[model samples]
Target: MRWWQCRLAAAVALLAAVLALGAAGPRSPAPLRFAPGGRFKLALFADLHYGENAWTDWGPAQDDASDRVMAAVLDAENPDFVVYLGDLVTANNVPVANASLYWDRAISPARRRGVPWSTVFGNHDDMPFEWPPEWFSPAGVPPVHCPPAASAMPEPDPGCIFRGTPRVELMTAELDRACGLSRSSVGPRELWPGVSNYVLQVLSHEKPHDPALLMYFLDSGGGSYPEVVSCAQVTWFHSQSRFLNPDGRIPELVFWHVPSTAYVKVAPKATSEVRKPCVGSLNEEDVAPQVAEWGMMDALAHRPSVKAIFVGHNHGLDWCCPYEKLWLCFARHTGHGGYGDWPRGARIVEVAEKKHFSVNSWIRMENGSTHSHVTLSSARFS
Candidate 1:
């Protein structure tokens, strides 16, 4: 029964323990669990709002700062693409000049990275101006009956000529301005020729079994003014939505400049005064109807294919309330470039397996050089 038997039993026990640890070794750190095969990464930043008078002085510097931060981020993450959700410029009633500068600066970084970039229109980009009266004096009266040529129109009109009183003169002026005559020699002639709005289709590098994605970039006009959707653009959007075949799968991503729903309401600060619902003001009444008319709520409610909507009008970070299956996110503005007290920042979005996504917000430090990244997992929706 003996000493040899006892030693044999101890040896067996030791071998069993070693085997157990070996079996569990591969599982220790846990495999990267993603949503089935859906695994890809992308970066998103919205409401850069470049070119405000205050920040104009530092526009180039801020652009360089943002460019550096974004370059570092893109180099580190190596996302598939990048998206800017609008308000690229602070229109400031100078859409022609200011928007051009903003676009150049705001996009210079992404362009430098050699990455594909897309965007939607924000309210600020659509800043409007009134038309001079001579454009519309009724026929048979005189040469005045003919709409004033673009050269003759006044500058600094308070209202949007396109949708305000004196509709005829305004419409003509809009045509002239859009045709690249008013602010000639600046801005992209094609882009400035008409209201900028369009749909973009993004395909994945992976196979059909892999996660497929498409982004719909809508032009939500600007401010609170009502502008009819042009017949051509509407038809085009409808066609794009219907025809997109993402590896034979539906669109998995939808991006826009404005929230489909009113995600934020003013909980007035103690010192703030009540104000009327105006075209440019941010109030319940002004925002609510705009949200409705654009059919944003309805589109979001029914479009199961749309996994998310990213926007940036409010300039503050926000996540969807009630937590729907869809994810909604707001990116901080970079317009401060290097001027404002608010930290300039951008967002990084990671789309993982099973339709799961994560957002990490980055803020430009006070030094106006470095960016501090903050994980926004709290805002992550399944």
Candidate 2:
């Protein structure tokens, strides 16, 4: 067999092993429980752009850095839960099936450390092959097996450059298999439009049904679609929040890959416009118009229970600024695959088991320095 065939075979064998292990019934993750004093620490790892130069030394080395960051954070914080804020891998250079390897490696640190974690999709997570097939041809012509009409279909044709299973599907499957207790068995039923929109409840006490905090994970519709949090998703969020808390009183923190448009206005000067103390680099980029504001911002503003929004798209910017009645924040880019040579780190948010349901958050670098500690809540922001 040829080199690509060999790689594919190896990847397939590895994937089969993973599936078998998942089927063999590994112990489900225990429910998230806080330490004494009703305090739970959660770590946010972002932009772990694994697979920069797949099947090469540099790419694997970059992933090693991500592993080190995760291991270091897990050791230091002993967090109750962990959240990977997307851009989990740069799979453009690898086969779609082998993409799961990167995901597997990215979450290994957390899994080994015995921490329950979740993920959100970033823009680059499900990208197509880096170079079109024609680039490899002596004649520079795309394969003509599929007709032009195939391009208009919802799924890419086998002959198309973008043809392959999306990395997001593999992601959700792996997460559910590895950390069953952290996610719902039903997997975001018809109520949510996207794959990753699900919730993890932090109980006020040991009772599984009594929820004190609700952690939401959203896909942000990146990769195949425009990177926007859809209106349907916003409605679903409202409905879920109400179903969970009929009195509309539970505290929530939302996590996703891309930031909403509000970040642009709040940090036009690379720093917060408000009087709040924001930290880390403000180096912001032009917000993608497709992803800019839909009604998600409005929904968040109107829902006073959502204490803050945490994201990880723009690797350069890491600030927690006030946008309307919510705190718009970015996770410090933790992977070395993408751009930026700034000191790498992860964001940490702590929720105390208190009556007020306030949150204390900050950033912790690989070297162990911390900054940008802040408290957020609708009452405080309002």
Candidate 3:
């Protein structure tokens, strides 16, 4: 064939392959938007903690429990968009070169349901593994039975490497999935090392021409780096919000894995019971916040458009309290692998299509129980 014909043929083959991938998977909806009834529902799954203790029977059982939790919440809420609010895997406990396998499993529920989703990194997401004393002691390590590896191995042998996967690799792999609706992205190169510092818009159902809401996902650094939102993120927020919502009329919400110091400030007293104005079921532990406050909260507080912020680091706390001009909320523990005896559940956020509407949130537990309903008005924020 001629050079031009050859190039055209190659392009056709590539398109065909892509189409095949899409056809092989579940059908997906259009880019995120409110339903025809002018309402958007979002479900937040936090601290899934997959890939923990793969060598033990109990570990896989816990992962199975986590899967059931996700499946139940997804079916119960049927969120238009889902956010894997981080700690999707206990990287330190994961004895593999790539934690993406667990990450993929964590997101599988949404993918199977054809729901769009996003993710942010948590401290446990990229933590390096610490050698267990038991492995070096009398207890022999279980030989990795994963195909190609020897059925039996010595104690000193490095059967698996758990150095942790980079944020870039995970993000790129998710984006490259077949017909996936993953909105996750590694933001500007300036924020290198901090992936998922991007913004998303939820379009209006009735007026498709305009955006109904603005959502910002930032990398609240953790694991390999200090648990704090860098100054660069604050600057990026101002720049992006200014350019996106010039007049600051559109309502905005923020999502990150680790809770900012502002959460501590707004947190209900550790000993006090959760009440109205503030709403949630569990308050068993104190606020496990970021390392320090680096002006991100100040920037958000100053922005009249920012209505609320969502975080998921403390599995035992799942409350939302008014902070400055916006609300600070924590998603419920949605995994069996984390450090909590609390029941698994997910936080649900719903917004109306109107420019001015109320933002309502509640927790949907695995056993079909829903509680801790709270509302934030867009007009009040405006």
- Candidate 1 Cα errors over 4 Å, as ranges: 1-39, 54-69, 93-98, 128-197, 204-211, 223-239, 245-251, 262-291, 322-324, 337-340, 353-382
Per-residue lDDT of candidate 1, residues 43-98 (tens digit): 66666655443223454455555666566556666655667666665554232322
Candidates sorted on lDDT, descending:
3, 2, 1
Expressed as tens digits, the lDDT of each residue in 1-382 for candidate 3 is 8999999999999999999998898655366788998898999999999978777787789999999999999998889999989899988888876777788889989999999998998988888876667787776676543222222344555547656777787777677672557988889999977888999998888878788899999998887888889999999999999999999877898999889888887778885798866878788888988888889999998888888999999988999888767889999999999797889999999998565576899999999999998886534432
Please give the distance, in angstroms, between residue 128's alpha carbon in candidate 3 and its true position after superposition. Answer: 1.1
Best candidate, lDDT: 3
lDDT of 2 by residue, 1-382 (tens): 9999999999999999999999998675666665657788899999998867654567668878878887877788788888988888785655434455577678778877667778777777777767746567796743332223311447754433333336446555566547453342223556333567878878875444577788888878676667888877877888888888768677888988888787777764643332444444545554332355668788878877788899888877777888767788888888888887888888999998666667888888888878777786546552
Instruction: List candidate 2 segments past 4 Å from native.
Output: 1-29, 132-164, 176-193, 206-209, 271-277, 281-292
| Model 2, global lDDT | 0.72
Provide the overall lDDT of each model, using Cα atoms, as 2-decimal numbers: 0.46, 0.72, 0.85
**lDDT for model 3, on a 0 to 1 scale?**
0.85
The TM-score obtained by model 2 is 0.79
